[model samples]
Every structure is written in structure tokens, then in C-alpha cells.
Target: LIATILLYMGVALFCGCGHEALSGTVSILLNYFDVTKGPGGGLDVFTIIDILKYIIYGLAAGFFVFGVLLLVEGFFTTGAIRDLYGEFKITACGRCLTAFLMFLAYLFFLVWLGVTAFTSLPVFMYYNVWSMCQNSSSMEGANLCLDLRLFGAVTVSEDRKVCTGTEKFSRMCVSDELDLTFHLFVCALAGAGAAVIAMVRRITLSSDCS
Candidate 1:
């Protein structure tokens, strides 16, 4: 039994490693998603470091996928399934509560995915236009006067001015901010799922009466 536990531990460790790698890659890609330089790698000055950022991002994404699979393996190995089954066989209240918990978990994932999809389209358009605005213009992308116009969209109120004259380079930062929002929502859903699983099942399946 100890040996089996050790094996599972190893599997969990492997999965965790992959997850971290992917997360790191995602961070790197997100960090430097936009890059442009003038001729001779000197005038405008963006270099290989910028290029490697995307590669790291891809690598991290791959590992994170692997890590998620590993975590799933750990979940089953830890007897989460058996525990749920045992809880289902208890009193009527226990069964109902378990069902509700599962439902919540499902609902959380569905809501998160729905919102993410809905948010993605506008974000894509913003990033593309922002990128074009920055690259096409001689001014630095980060400058408030040249490349960013999206911020104007954020503060448009009936009482306020139209404020249409936006700089061109602000989209990268806006995109990053959006990514963080999605990450926060994803983390919240995951937390809710974990809470439901941990709270709903009181008895182990091994304890169930035949």
C-alpha cells in the first residue's frame, strides 16, 4: 500500500511539474505578445528575447494541460469517486445534498466557459486593431497619444465627451488586464468546485452498507 501511494505521489508530482511549466509559458507569452523593431535590430530594438517569450508561452500551455491530467489521476486515486458513491447511499438528505453539490460544480464550469467565450470575441478585435495601430505608427506603442484608443471606449458616458482620440499602443496592456480577469474567474470556479466536492461527501465508499 505504501508503494502504491508513493507511485501516485510521483504521478501527482509529474503532473504538477507540467502544470507549472505551462503556466509559466502562458505568462511569458502574455507578457510580450506584441513586438516590433526597426531595421537592423537596432533602430526600433526588439530582439530574440521577445520571440522566445511566445515559445515559452506555448511550452507552458502544453505542460499545464499535462498537469491537469495528472491532477485528475490524483483525484481518482485518492478515492473521491468511492466517497461520492458512499455518500449517495446514505440517508435521503445525504443523497439530495450530494446531488446539489454536483449540480453546483457543473453549473460553475458552464458559467465560466460561457462567460469566457463571450468575452473572447471583443478582446480579439481589440488586440488586432491595437496591434495594427501600434505597428503601423512610428510612435512607441505604450505612448498615450499615439497607439491606444480603447480606453476611450471604457469611459464613454452620456455626460462625458466622446473622447475618440485614443493612442494606438494601449491594447497590449488592456489584453493583459482582460486575461487576468479571466484567470480570476477561472480560479473562483475551481475553488467552488473543490469546496462542493470536499463538503458533500461525508462517508467513504468503503463504509457503505451492502
Candidate 2:
């Protein structure tokens, strides 16, 4: 167990070490994702250290998958299936524990999804667009002034005039509501499936139920 944990930690470090910093618009998203901090790198830069932020995160997630595989593989070799000291077999207990815990996890996830779907749903639906607008407009996707002109958002000129129909100096605000709106569906579906597991059942601690 100790060795496996150490191995995982080592892999994690290696995965992060090569990633170098970047700047500019890419860095803007990276920073927002908490991939890197501070200002962007000075200018065009490249090296072994300049690892793509997304790639680093992907590799980190992969390391976790590998670590889980290692842990589960331990189960068959040294886990529930294997006997210790030729006297005790913990396979039954381990199996029961695993099932019970997994079911609980499923239920918890469902409840969490339901809650998140409720929260981010309205913000992206255009009804709540006013919350972001500096003015009285409460429409979603209201920040396309410089991009689109026919939307509900408003932009102003240098003299405080409403940008009613011109595209000179546009004003816009960005929102993740649309993306969250889509995610709401995915979360709802997964949550409903998890609910189908119904309630968690009791697992027998021993190989025999009696």
C-alpha cells in the first residue's frame, strides 16, 4: 500500500514537472481554469517546460486511473481473494464493503446533480441575463455587442449614448450559462440512472449469510 501510494505521487510529480507557463489569451483561459497563475509568459515561448495545460490535467487524471487499476489488481492478488496466514479470508468482508460504499456514492451523486442543475439552470436561460448586464436588460447572452448586434444586450458610446443600432465600440459580457444549461441535462440523466440502483442493500459480512 505504501509503495503504491508513493508510486502514484511520483507519477503525479513527473506529470506536472514538464508543464511550462504560457501567456496571452490562452493563458487567460488557463488561469481561469486554475491551470497556472500570474501574468502570461513574456512572449512566444517554447521548451520542454511549455507543456500544454490541458494535457497536463489529462495526464494527471490518467495517473489516477492507473493508480486505481493498481489498487483493484491488488484486491485479487492480495485483497479479498487472498488468505492471510492461512487462517482468515477477508474476501467476503471486502466485497460487502465495496458494494455498500459504491451504492452510497451513487445516491450522493444523484442528490448533488439535482442541486447543481437547479442552480446553474436559470443563469444561462436568458431570464437571468440582467444580473450580468450593467443596465436594466435581464436577458441571457446579452454580451454579444462587439460580436452580434441583434441580441438583447446593450453597449454604449464614448458620450454615454445607447448603442441602439451601431457596432462602433461594442460592449459585451461573457457567461457560462449556455454551457451549464447543456450540462444540466447530462447531470439530470446521470442522476436519474443512479437513482435506479434504488436503495442500498445490506451485504453479508461473511461468505455465508447465516
Candidate 3:
């Protein structure tokens, strides 16, 4: 309970309530690595790489959550899982196997969500720019850059082909999809955790039954 509270606090701090408005908290980090600007209108490889990096980071974050569960299990190796399932009690190695497997499944979902979100985040927040060519001279030394108009609000480009319409929709969709996955993973993990707790209770009940 305490840990969950702290986690909520941390998210709230980063997301803020209504006092201060903020946008794409993580996209700001990608800006630092972006260099696709100037008169060339060339591609920004660095920014792309960084965005990819963050996607991986997000995925890793999800995996880390599952890793924590592994650490917890390592500390408390109990035989309750075996007692709950007769097969586990009959076989020396079978005891607690099902619980462990279920726990593993929970962790797997977590890691999968982490990875999926990691790659999808930047694409979800991507934007494009557009500009018209009036004269040959303008094309000689003209370059384009994606400027954050309202701090992750709208990425303005020289061409004015803002990534606001289709891009924004696509990104929002991806973010929502990843978010749903995260929530589902959380639910599964919670269920697994609850099962473990129940098994522990069952063990106690069995002892009392005898």
C-alpha cells in the first residue's frame, strides 16, 4: 500500500494536476538529440535514434516492474503452492510450479508492454513540417526544423504541413493502445499477486484443518 501510494505521488508530480500545464514530458528529452534543422531540410538521424532509444527505455521500464516481482519471489520461497494443488504435494518438484509459472506469465506481459510502449511512444508524438518553394533562391539555402510551438503542442515546420492532423491522430491512437496494454498487464500482475497471497492463506488453512 505504501509503495503504491508513493508511485501515485511520483506520477502525479510528473503529470501535475491542473496548476501547471505540460505536454509530452518525455518528448522534451528527444529534442536535445534532434539536429534536423538549418537550410538543408535534411533528416535528423540523431533525433530519430534518440526517439528509438526512449522507446526502448519505456519498454525496459515495464520489464523492470516484473523484475521486482522476481526479486520478491526469490525472497519468499514457500510450499503453499504445492499444498493448494495435490500434484505439487505428490511430486517433489511439482510443488509451487504452477504458481511460479503464473507469476512468470505476469512478468512476461509486463516486459512485452514495456517494449511495445517504448517503440510506439515517439511515433505517437511525431510531427512533420511543410513549406512552399516560391523562388529558386529560397531553395538554395533553405532548411526546415520542427519547432515545438506550445511545448509539445504542435510541431511547426517551414512547409506548414503540420503533423497535427493525421500524425496527431495516429500518435494518440498508439498511446492509447499502449496504455491499454499497460493497464491489462497491471491487472494480470495484480491477479497473480493475489493468487500467491491466496495460496499462502490456503496453506495456513490446511495446517488448521489437520
- lDDT, candidate 1, 53-153, per-residue tens: 36435534653453344344334435566677765444666555445534543553354355336334434544554555445455434432322124322
Candidate achieving the largest TM-score: 1
For every model shown, what is its TM-score relative to the native structure? 0.30, 0.26, 0.25
Residue 147: error of model 2 in Å?
41
- Model number with the top lDDT: 1
Model with the higher lDDT, candidate 1 or 2: 1
Output the worst ten-in-a-row residue range by lDDT, candidate 2.
Answer: 198-207
lDDT of candidate 1? 0.38
Residue 18 of model 1, lDDT score: 28
Candidate 2 Cα outliers beyond 4 Å, as residue runs: 20-51, 84-210
Question: For residues 64-135, what per-residue lDDT tens digits would candidate 2 score against the true structure?
Answer: 774465456444445344445566554777666565545544554454355335423422433333333444
